[model samples]
Target: MESDMTAALIRPVAIKLDEVTKARVKRLAEARHRTSHWLMREAITQYVDREEKREAFRQDTLRAWDEYRSTGLHVRADEADAWLAELEQGKDIEPPPCHK
Candidate 1:
Protein backbone atom coordinates (compact mmCIF):
# COMPACT_ATOMS: atom_id res chain seq x y z
CA MET A 1 0.00 0.00 0.00
CA GLU A 2 1.07 3.58 -0.52
CA SER A 3 2.56 5.00 2.64
CA ASP A 4 1.36 8.46 3.65
CA MET A 5 3.80 9.98 6.11
CA THR A 6 2.20 13.42 6.04
CA ALA A 7 -0.73 12.51 8.28
CA ALA A 8 1.64 11.41 11.06
CA LEU A 9 3.32 14.80 11.19
CA ILE A 10 0.25 17.01 10.96
CA ARG A 11 -0.74 19.10 13.97
CA PRO A 12 -3.39 21.74 14.58
CA VAL A 13 -1.97 25.26 14.43
CA ALA A 14 -3.44 28.25 16.19
CA ILE A 15 -2.80 31.74 14.92
CA LYS A 16 -3.92 35.11 16.17
CA LEU A 17 -5.04 37.34 13.33
CA ASP A 18 -4.85 41.09 13.28
CA GLU A 19 -8.02 43.04 14.04
CA VAL A 20 -8.66 44.08 10.43
CA THR A 21 -8.23 40.57 9.08
CA LYS A 22 -10.36 39.13 11.86
CA ALA A 23 -13.07 41.66 11.25
CA ARG A 24 -13.12 40.92 7.50
CA VAL A 25 -13.24 37.20 8.09
CA LYS A 26 -15.98 37.61 10.69
CA ARG A 27 -18.01 39.72 8.28
CA LEU A 28 -17.58 37.16 5.50
CA ALA A 29 -18.55 34.32 7.79
CA GLU A 30 -21.58 36.21 9.10
CA ALA A 31 -22.76 36.86 5.56
CA ARG A 32 -22.48 33.16 4.79
CA HIS A 33 -24.16 32.17 8.06
CA ARG A 34 -21.07 30.20 9.05
CA THR A 35 -18.79 30.43 12.07
CA SER A 36 -15.18 31.65 11.84
CA HIS A 37 -14.01 28.10 12.48
CA TRP A 38 -16.06 26.85 9.53
CA LEU A 39 -14.59 29.53 7.30
CA MET A 40 -11.09 28.66 8.46
CA ARG A 41 -11.68 24.96 7.84
CA GLU A 42 -13.03 25.63 4.36
CA ALA A 43 -10.00 27.78 3.52
CA ILE A 44 -7.63 25.13 4.84
CA THR A 45 -9.41 22.40 2.88
CA GLN A 46 -9.00 24.36 -0.37
CA TYR A 47 -5.34 25.02 0.34
CA VAL A 48 -4.71 21.36 1.08
CA ASP A 49 -6.44 20.28 -2.13
CA ARG A 50 -4.24 22.61 -4.20
CA GLU A 51 -1.08 21.48 -2.44
CA GLU A 52 -2.01 17.82 -2.95
CA LYS A 53 -2.40 18.39 -6.69
CA ARG A 54 1.03 20.07 -6.86
CA GLU A 55 2.63 17.23 -4.92
CA ALA A 56 0.98 14.61 -7.11
CA PHE A 57 2.20 16.35 -10.25
CA ARG A 58 5.74 16.42 -8.89
CA GLN A 59 5.60 12.75 -7.94
CA ASP A 60 4.24 11.73 -11.34
CA THR A 61 7.00 13.65 -13.11
CA LEU A 62 9.63 11.93 -10.99
CA ARG A 63 8.02 8.56 -11.53
CA ALA A 64 8.03 9.08 -15.29
CA TRP A 65 11.72 9.96 -15.21
CA ASP A 66 12.57 6.93 -13.07
CA GLU A 67 10.58 4.61 -15.26
CA TYR A 68 12.33 5.92 -18.34
CA ARG A 69 15.77 5.54 -16.77
CA SER A 70 15.17 1.98 -15.62
CA THR A 71 13.20 0.67 -18.59
CA GLY A 72 14.79 2.73 -21.41
CA LEU A 73 11.30 3.89 -22.44
CA HIS A 74 8.86 6.50 -21.34
CA VAL A 75 5.97 5.27 -19.24
CA ARG A 76 2.80 5.37 -21.31
CA ALA A 77 -0.72 5.87 -20.02
CA ASP A 78 -1.74 2.65 -21.72
CA GLU A 79 1.06 0.66 -20.09
CA ALA A 80 -1.55 -1.33 -18.18
CA ASP A 81 -3.41 -2.35 -21.34
CA ALA A 82 -3.24 -6.04 -20.46
CA TRP A 83 -4.79 -5.53 -17.06
CA LEU A 84 -7.46 -3.24 -18.50
CA ALA A 85 -8.20 -5.72 -21.22
CA GLU A 86 -8.71 -8.46 -18.66
CA LEU A 87 -11.34 -6.33 -16.91
CA GLU A 88 -13.03 -5.53 -20.22
CA GLN A 89 -13.20 -9.25 -20.93
CA GLY A 90 -15.43 -9.72 -17.84
CA LYS A 91 -12.60 -11.33 -15.91
CA ASP A 92 -12.57 -10.68 -12.18
CA ILE A 93 -9.25 -8.96 -12.23
CA GLU A 94 -7.94 -7.95 -8.82
CA PRO A 95 -6.71 -4.46 -8.15
CA PRO A 96 -3.06 -3.85 -9.00
CA PRO A 97 -0.86 -4.55 -5.98
CA CYS A 98 0.69 -1.64 -4.18
CA HIS A 99 4.03 -1.27 -2.52
CA LYS A 100 4.99 0.46 0.70
Candidate 2:
Protein backbone atom coordinates (compact mmCIF):
# COMPACT_ATOMS: atom_id res chain seq x y z
CA MET A 1 0.00 0.00 0.00
CA GLU A 2 2.82 2.39 0.87
CA SER A 3 4.65 1.45 -2.32
CA ASP A 4 1.54 2.19 -4.36
CA MET A 5 1.17 5.58 -2.63
CA THR A 6 4.83 6.37 -3.31
CA ALA A 7 4.49 5.38 -6.95
CA ALA A 8 1.39 7.60 -7.33
CA LEU A 9 3.12 10.55 -5.70
CA ILE A 10 6.35 10.37 -7.73
CA ARG A 11 5.04 10.86 -11.24
CA PRO A 12 7.16 12.84 -13.74
CA VAL A 13 5.71 16.13 -15.06
CA ALA A 14 7.39 18.14 -17.79
CA ILE A 15 7.22 21.93 -18.02
CA LYS A 16 8.83 24.32 -20.46
CA LEU A 17 10.93 27.27 -19.32
CA ASP A 18 12.94 29.89 -21.18
CA GLU A 19 16.70 29.43 -21.03
CA VAL A 20 17.19 32.44 -18.71
CA THR A 21 14.41 31.29 -16.35
CA LYS A 22 15.76 27.74 -16.40
CA ALA A 23 19.26 28.99 -15.54
CA ARG A 24 17.84 31.07 -12.68
CA VAL A 25 15.97 28.06 -11.29
CA LYS A 26 19.11 25.94 -11.49
CA ARG A 27 21.19 28.58 -9.72
CA LEU A 28 18.61 29.05 -6.96
CA ALA A 29 18.23 25.29 -6.54
CA GLU A 30 21.98 24.87 -6.18
CA ALA A 31 22.17 27.75 -3.71
CA ARG A 32 19.39 26.11 -1.63
CA HIS A 33 21.19 22.73 -1.75
CA ARG A 34 18.24 21.12 -3.53
CA THR A 35 17.84 19.51 -6.94
CA SER A 36 16.08 21.53 -9.69
CA HIS A 37 13.24 19.01 -9.70
CA TRP A 38 12.83 19.36 -5.95
CA LEU A 39 12.84 23.16 -6.17
CA MET A 40 10.23 23.17 -8.95
CA ARG A 41 8.09 20.68 -7.05
CA GLU A 42 8.24 22.85 -3.93
CA ALA A 43 7.37 25.95 -5.95
CA ILE A 44 4.35 24.22 -7.49
CA THR A 45 3.23 22.87 -4.14
CA GLN A 46 3.42 26.28 -2.47
CA TYR A 47 1.65 27.97 -5.36
CA VAL A 48 -1.19 25.43 -5.25
CA ASP A 49 -1.52 25.70 -1.48
CA ARG A 50 -1.64 29.49 -1.59
CA GLU A 51 -4.16 29.54 -4.43
CA GLU A 52 -6.38 27.01 -2.67
CA LYS A 53 -6.49 29.17 0.44
CA ARG A 54 -7.21 32.26 -1.63
CA GLU A 55 -10.07 30.49 -3.40
CA ALA A 56 -11.48 29.34 -0.08
CA PHE A 57 -11.39 32.90 1.24
CA ARG A 58 -13.09 34.16 -1.91
CA GLN A 59 -15.86 31.59 -1.47
CA ASP A 60 -16.30 32.47 2.18
CA THR A 61 -16.53 36.15 1.36
CA LEU A 62 -19.20 35.47 -1.25
CA ARG A 63 -21.19 33.34 1.16
CA ALA A 64 -20.94 35.98 3.85
CA TRP A 65 -22.17 38.64 1.41
CA ASP A 66 -25.10 36.48 0.41
CA GLU A 67 -26.06 35.80 4.01
CA TYR A 68 -25.85 39.47 4.91
CA ARG A 69 -28.02 40.41 1.94
CA SER A 70 -30.61 37.80 2.81
CA THR A 71 -30.88 38.47 6.55
CA GLY A 72 -29.56 42.02 6.95
CA LEU A 73 -28.09 40.91 10.26
CA HIS A 74 -24.56 41.94 11.16
CA VAL A 75 -22.51 43.47 13.92
CA ARG A 76 -21.64 47.15 13.65
CA ALA A 77 -18.01 47.96 12.82
CA ASP A 78 -17.66 49.94 16.05
CA GLU A 79 -19.01 47.05 18.10
CA ALA A 80 -16.63 44.64 16.36
CA ASP A 81 -13.73 46.99 16.96
CA ALA A 82 -14.60 47.24 20.65
CA TRP A 83 -14.77 43.48 20.93
CA LEU A 84 -11.42 43.08 19.21
CA ALA A 85 -9.87 45.74 21.43
CA GLU A 86 -11.04 43.88 24.52
CA LEU A 87 -9.53 40.66 23.20
CA GLU A 88 -6.26 42.41 22.41
CA GLN A 89 -6.13 43.57 26.04
CA GLY A 90 -6.29 39.86 27.10
CA LYS A 91 -9.99 39.59 27.78
CA ASP A 92 -11.68 36.26 26.96
CA ILE A 93 -15.18 37.54 26.21
CA GLU A 94 -17.56 36.28 23.54
CA PRO A 95 -18.02 38.08 20.24
CA PRO A 96 -20.72 40.75 19.89
CA PRO A 97 -24.07 39.37 18.81
CA CYS A 98 -25.27 40.00 15.26
CA HIS A 99 -28.40 42.18 14.87
CA LYS A 100 -30.75 43.26 12.17
Best by lDDT: 2
Residue pairs with backbone overlap in model 1: none
- Residue-wise C-alpha lDDT for candidate 1, range 15-98, written one tens digit per residue: 899999999999999999999988988998999999999999999999987876777754344646766888999999875543
List where candidate 1 sits over 4 angstroms from the true fold.
1-13, 74-100
User: Per-residue CA lDDT of candidate 2, range 1-100, in tens?
Assistant: 9999998888787899999999999999999999999999999999999999999999999999999999999999999999999999999999999999
Per-residue lDDT, model 1, residue 49, is 100
Clashes by residue pair, model 2: none
Worst 10 residues of 1 by lDDT: 73-82
Worst 10 residues of 2 by lDDT: 5-14
Q: Rate the local accuracy (lDDT) of all candidates.
A: 0.81, 0.97
Look at candidate 1 and tell me the lDDT of residue 87.
Answer: 90
TM-score of each: 0.53, 0.91
